[model samples]
Target chain A: MKTYLKLAAPMALAAALAPVPAAAAWRLVDQGETRKVARSTLVVTAPEEWNRATERPSSRSEVWTQDGIALSELTFYAKIKDGETLFKRRQGKRNPLPEFDKDMLPTDLVEWYEDTANIVLGGSLFEIVEVTPATLAGYPGVHLRYSYTGGDNVARLGEARVAIIDEKLYLISFEAPRLHYFDRYIAGVRAMMDNARFK
Target chain B: MKRLLASAALIGLFAQPLLAQETGDETPEEKPLPSAHGYEPQDDLEKGLWYEMDEAEKSLKESRFLIEEPALNAYVRSVLCQTVGDERCAATRLYLLRTPQFNASMAPNGVVLVYSGLLLRMRDEAQLAAVLGHEFTHFEKQHSLRIFRQIRTKTDLLSWRSVVPVRLPYPAGMATQLAVLGSVYDFNRDMEREADAGSIEELVRAGYDPRAASAIWSQLGAEMDATAEERGHRSDKNRNGGLFATHPRSTDRMGRLAYLAREAAGDGAGELYRGAEEYRAAIGPWWAQLIEDQIALKDFGGTEYLLATLAGDDPLGWTGDLLYARGELYRARAEDGDFAQAADFYRQAIATGEFPAESWRGLGLSLMRAGQKPEGQAALRSYLELRPEAPDAALLASMAGEAAS
Candidate 1:
């Protein structure tokens, strides 16, 4: 999965996915469940995103997590390889995203997305149900229709329609409401993805 | 009363071995795994986490009796300690916490402490094993002290958003650091990548679906996302805890683990070790509380994800009650005038047979919210007739009055 993070999505995906699921093997890999996105890497990777996302190119709208009443931000770096693995920089003032202290900390879809990116390349059939074939950018891709179920409710309070394009496992994914968001932004998403090349 | 007594007695009696004399690793060969960065099991950090595997054994002996209800205790311990009934894995001693939160932890000494909320959330053995697998990797890879040292140092953090400056005083005390640790206890980023990889194998070795890891991540994501939405934020930090902090992210792990789970799929004897009915039967007492707690917290996403996961095991007929619960959740939401959407949930509840009485009441509530007074009145009446002694009878009746012509 970290391999996919390298933008060598396909090859990294293959390496991450091909292994057998075994506890011993996991011991062989590494162990830390703290997962947060590194924005510096993203910013470094794509400077245009800041301007495009908030329409505030001049004022950098650094992403901040709303913790209780405060919005704290980090100088995050996503491009770190095992070269300077997490262990080397485990302690410092800069708190990692998704603090690993609590037993059940909140994780967003991005973490799952990164994890699944590796899975997608792992060679198992990630069956997409209720989806259609679509061109996202120049890369041929598929639209995924997924539903989320909640324990407290009978009606699925959530539905996600995601548009995606993949070339050798480097995925360009766009998530929006199945009813409107996906349809509305798919073209822009496609263009953005098409415009993107490996950084 | 009997169950409680038996539990107390077990806690008292079984706690003996925990107090008994035990041995430690005096020899170089017997040293515990080092948890410090660049430290190996044979190193000093390992010494910190494994001060006593023997003491862990002692604790297990003492704690065995803590869960007095033999069957429940034994079954739960079996699920957590035993490696999916696999002969290849050793049974580790797991501690039971008295906390009511949703969580579990693994001591470096192989002591696994499971939270009651975990049992409440899991619908089957596979899901339980899925979580256990993640923890098992912690022990197997000896990550206990690795993270401990990482937190002590207060290190690397990851985020998709731009890094904003957080002003901190020089050399803060352990007190503020501990609290900050709770919020931002940074573990080595490598450990996160390790867990992602380890979770894959742990699930496979345990005879559970490794993919459950990805599913769990997705479930976790939805839960947090939903809670944030409930609490009013497009990007809330309450939910992005440990796993997300470690590194890469669940997104990448999904792809990595998917590859891992696939290998064992073709193995002839590989059936995921889970049965929803059996899971419910084991922890029947805690289900309602778990559902209610998560709901009260208004974590619709996690709630929904949990229900869906249970529903996926619908072959075991466990989804009906969950479906009903979901309907009630929507009724509670009632935000941005989503009453009609809540009404649809009631219909599904009826379709699934979850909570007949409440689903009817919720249907009425949704109807009234959507301004269908006549139908809402009839629905409330039906609810009252169905469960005249319901806990919310007064409220229901008042609502009924408002809806009535």
Candidate 2:
């Protein structure tokens, strides 16, 4: 079923100016079972138990979180069509998310993430700590690590692995508070990435 | 507090010229100012307003987004002081914020926040002075106090005042405060006209080109038009419309200011300085950061217009950065044949021999997207060689291996 996720206020203003509840719905995903992610053309086994957001799914992406989205989030993207953004709601803003392109390089992807966080996530400060290439789902991909201070003045750390395969884009990303949440769950995220494979 | 008292003393010293002007003395040595120097809240109502603004100012001081560049800060302060006069300038404090919107605001308590976006758009010191003078007028005229009293009459001022300092992400608090300030104390057309006219007079008196005042608004209008065209919308509906529309349209403002400038110029001044070189030198170090902020907004149309404008001013000095920016823009736009265009620009940047290492990576990706695998692989190899420890290095190596086969 098609779902509509309405971000009632601008992302930049929502967290700091007005604390609006993220109108996302979730489902429980038990550990050790390979499950198909929403709308994506791939399936993966969870390393452990986690909560997956069922709201705001496109034909190519889904989100899971060990804690809440504000504290930590894991997102998956599969076969995102060219000219489509990873997040649906972001397509409406004055500075909307950049569209995905098959020809995008790792650097381009990094820029896309940066723009998304700054313009869509309402991050006041954003910096890319590092970017390196990696193999994703047995395909050439790039890994990006970044730090951003959001409008709420909370510092967050994020990491993403992205690849373009079969003329379509695929990505997995995780973000959490840099203080503790990032270190708390990064090993699990890495393990999940290690186990992930395209179906 | 000492600055305020000193301002009060200077008011009397300067009051004679103002009184003379009031009596219609043509070419008076000094113009009459609307508010005396060393202004303080006259009553509890004004005091309450200042209290709220003072808190907001404190938060602003602590804001992470404030650009802490000493040289840039000093340069901007010098311009503001030149326009407002050093004695009166002491009553105001300027905060250079790193926001990527073309906005500047002055709170009642002498806090002036200038966004980097405005700095990016400014062509010369005269333009910067014009904007500063306009904002200073807002403070000098006590517009915020007037608006606060009006809001107090209509709504509970205490509730509104409390909300101003809510912790919000990035610029959310600042944006909220600005939004609330705008909603409650929306400057009427007459106020804007006064500020605009006052700023022109200030520019002329400071020996700046009065014409530069009109040029800024005109350029802003043109940029908005370009943005509208790119977004397939009517010019009237452009996002920059709110601020520009709130004031007099650029055409009308430009016409009036040009007339005022002509009148001011009639006294036979040979030439007025725009201080273009001085302005560039002061802002040069921050250009890359400012440009990065603009591009991060992902407004292709606006970014392209801004880069083109800057490039037009100093093509040789800005060539490498301009070419790299253009390449990034085209790549981000990702339209048909854009990859080829991006590749071309990246190559041009690389040829400059002063390019950022990212240019090599960009060229590699652009070439690969354009279906020139061998050339693309070679370029990527060059990038890997240069920035071997880049976070995405392994990915590039993998891509190169794939291309080799």
Candidate 3:
């Protein structure tokens, strides 16, 4: 009986460490299944099983995480209207997020992300390491790669792919700690991006 | 009553020469400052306060935010020593931090934290000396202990939580720490006035320009006004936000400092020095990084004012960076036709041939916004050619392709 309890103890701890899905907020995303992302105008097919976070679904965005937001996060933005900002609205601020403009260039998109990281997110150190052009949803888009030292003093790396289609903005981004988490999930993110489609 | 009146008259007699000095019409003979040495807290409460501050100092020493550049550190220490005299300076330990806020605070234990933003704004050694002297006076006068005692008396529940640990995790924790520091240990108006008067006296005695005190305050006022104007709000007469926000408006502070400067300098202003060139040379290597930090705040009006102020001093040396910064400022503002203005600045920056590769990308975007598609596409192609491995290269190529068609 003692040996059985010892074996069960390790199993219990393992269960605790594993990602626990909030019954109402999350649904299992099976491998090779194409599913519509909440609030976004696009759909994605996961190459593997993943958890979709739906705790706070809005008309503009959605979040998916393998571990948790702290480890890694994949955020999607649908057809964000011209003059609208990404993410939830905040109050009592002079400058909110830069409003999306129909005429925004890839450079403008990069600047917007920079401002979001430095000004909105209040990073201690934010640097754009590279900027290149990419295709998203069969449309020309910008790919921005940046790093920031977050308030916690942990270094983080982020990549964003953004495009303007039919005067609306579509964005997909991944952020994770630069240690092991960023590289660990980057391949999966790229695969997911490869399978992403807009109806 | 007769004795009090006589003393008041005597004070007025002493003040007259100082007032005359403000107009550069007369000079008062320099009086030797009292030797500052062997300062120790006499009371139990004061000793306890010092002990608490010593712990904070220990934690601050280990903070990653502390700027550890030996040259910059030594330069600041030398200035503090000059201002306070070497004997008293021995008791103070200065730490420079890279935080982008215009503040310098002295702990009761003689640990002074000077923020990078303050260093960026100071145009000369005299200005920095005035600020350092003011903080030094706060330490010498035991203002923090008095404030701590008052708060302790008012709230029994004030806990150790107020002293935020330096290693606390990211953004939320940092915000809480900053908020706590902002609200805690703020000295009363009387203490601030005393520090101002005492610092000016120290500045003059240290051979720095007395007028630099008022000049710093005036610049702060102008920055505040510009910020207000840019936000489309009427400048508030009472809006005091930066270093003096807790003390008084810049106008009031400037008025008092100007009066005191005259009193302190009298006719000896010519002997004093601003040390502008020497100061610039000392801080030269760090200036560009400091300016970038300020711009990262996205406070367009304040940054614009700062660039203009620095440009006025050395336009030829500052032109390339200034033009690029102006383009960035206009791009962020994003008002109608602001893109065209931004494009023009980028063009000027590119003409200098010393601008960052990002300038080419900025020019391309601005041109596109201005409806010059072909020119914009050509510039974008140039950006791609220069930065072949840029993260956004694919997108730029696609745009260029569309433009050609």
Q: Which candidate number maximizes TM-score? A: 2
What DockQ results for candidate 1?
A: 0.01
* Per-candidate local distance difference test: 0.42, 0.68, 0.67
Question: What would the per-residue lDDT of candidate 1 be over residues B181-252, giving only the tens digit for each residue?
Answer: 112222344554666566666656666665556665555556556545544655332223333322334566
In terms of DockQ, the best-performing candidate is 2
- The model with the greater lDDT, 1 or 2, is 2
* Error of model 3, residue B230, in angstroms: 2.5
Runs in model 3 deviating more than 4 A are A1-24, A92-95, B1-66, B155-184, B233-241, B313-318, B348-361, B377-405
lDDT, candidate 2, A97-153, per-residue tens: 667776676667777777766676543377888877776778777788887765445
Model 1's CAPRI class is: incorrect
Sort order, DockQ high to low: 2, 3, 1
Identify the leading candidate in terms of lDDT: 2
Give the lowest summed-lDDT range of ten residues in model 1 chain B: B169-178
Instruction: Report per-candidate TM-score of chain A alone.
Output: 0.26, 0.82, 0.82
Which of the two candidates, 1 or 3, achieves a greater DockQ against the reference?
Answer: 3
lDDT of 2 at B10: 21
Q: Is 1 or 3 the stronger prediction by lDDT? A: 3
Indicate whether candidate 2 or candidate 3 has the larger TM-score: 2
